[model samples]
Target: MKNLLIIILAALLYTIATGNTAAQEMGDKEKMKIFTNWIGRWEGEGSMQMGPGEPRKSKVDERVEAKLDGMVLLVEGVGKAQDASKQEIVVHHALAVLSYDKNTEQYKFRSYLKDGRSTDAWIKPTGENTFQWGFDIPGRGKTRYSIVLDPVKKTWDETGEFSQDGNTWMKFFSMHLTKTE
Candidate 1:
């Protein structure tokens, strides 16, 4: 009777350990799929509000790819628009990495710009097809960026907004992207 009890306990422990390992692997793969959907070259048009004047129209291109065995997504974006004076074309470049955090159970974003500016934001899933990344801007309130993916249309729509009171949002930029490959 004692031998049988020991064998049963050992079997239960093995099952529990293997089950948790399998679940964790499956969870990671599922999370990876969410980011892999954005992997491809995208071209689009966008507009940005740089100053007090009107928003300037711009040409935008972005590329996203899975890295680190699908553990992270690397994104690169370029925007070309006329300057405030409309005298020359202004180019803006940015790079970003999106990764899932197991401890936080959420995704994190780290972005770097050509002007040597960088931002770290937390990502939230707002809807079935939409995700929002946001950060507090100290005295400026908050800034949020949202992206909606349309799988059927193979398009990505993104918007940037700022809120002084955290209740009223003012849009400052918008982009519409179509997958190129």
Candidate 2:
């Protein structure tokens, strides 16, 4: 009985120590440039291909703030239809962000919707001013977003793709945003 108790205690200690190490590593900050440039106010218009014959347009407002706690960044965003009827037809959408882990060296995107569900994304820069972010949904589907920022034009281009086979991509939404003062 004493030997069994010692074995169990050792296993518990091993698990706890491994878990703590992983958590500590995740909290470190790594990517700095990506977070700094993304900090600002942005506004744009977006369109979604709901179906072959169904398409919708909406306005997008995004705000990114630098967090004082280490290398963390906060983001807030809202999307609403321009037309009253369209607005009434669909559900409200909004997002609140806490912090981004720089140690992972990946752009992390998350949003809390009005429907009480939260979505998260991991992003990576593909080019100088281009980045890709993707999210996975358990039973529904997965979406990958590509964004491009033009400093001279002060505009942003975004495209969203949905995948089923994980390799095939289909356009789900597209947006063009102009920076707002």
Candidate 3:
């Protein structure tokens, strides 16, 4: 009876240890939950500097969704603004995917633009409700975008900054959105 009790205790201890290890091994799905508040439809206005000229204003729409069994977030955005003749035209259109890489233990952001410009960048979670993503341009400069979602107010604010010397930054873009759904 004493030997049997010892074996049972050892088995229980081993099971508990393995269970804790498994629980602590976070997967991609768990990491993706950081974007939960961003999973919705949003509409608002945005502006971006096109040149040394003034920034153009436009109405923007964003749809964020969870795909691949919640392992990735698919983000689609469209911006419409009036042309010189006051005709509504597409100012910007983009599709992006956000995913957490288990191997790298980091988030990846890939964006596709209407102008055939695409970028594969890194995304860092700044807080429970914020994410910043960007990439470095070899000869030009680096551009970074930061997005903050206010769950209480159901608002999303994003800003874009560019740096040429890795120190001084210029704010070139901004978007203010309200959750529509």
Give the number of the best model, judged by TM-score. Answer: 3
Per lDDT, the best of the predicted structures is 3
Model 1: per-residue Cα lDDT over 1-181, one tens digit each: 9999999999999999999988986787688676665889999998889669978778898999888778889999998876668754647799999988877887889999999989898887777778899888877799999999987899999999999999999999899999998
Which candidate order results from sorting by TM-score in descending order?
3, 1, 2
Q: What ranges in model 3 sit over 4 Å off?
A: 1-26
Q: Which pairs of residues collide in model 3?
A: none
* TM-score to native of every candidate shown: 0.81, 0.71, 0.84
Model 2 has how many clashing residue pairs?
A: 2
Candidate 1 off by > 4 Å: 1-23, 83-90
Q: Give one digit per residue, the lDDT tens place, for model 2 in 111-149.
A: 677788887777778887888887887887788989898
Ranking by lDDT: 3, 1, 2
- Pairs that collide, model 1: none
Q: Write the per-residue lDDT of candidate 3 for residues 1-181, one digit (tens) a residue.
A: 9999999999999999998766645455788888989899999999999579889999999999999878899999999999989999998999999988767788889999999999999888897798888999889999999999999999999999999988999999999999998
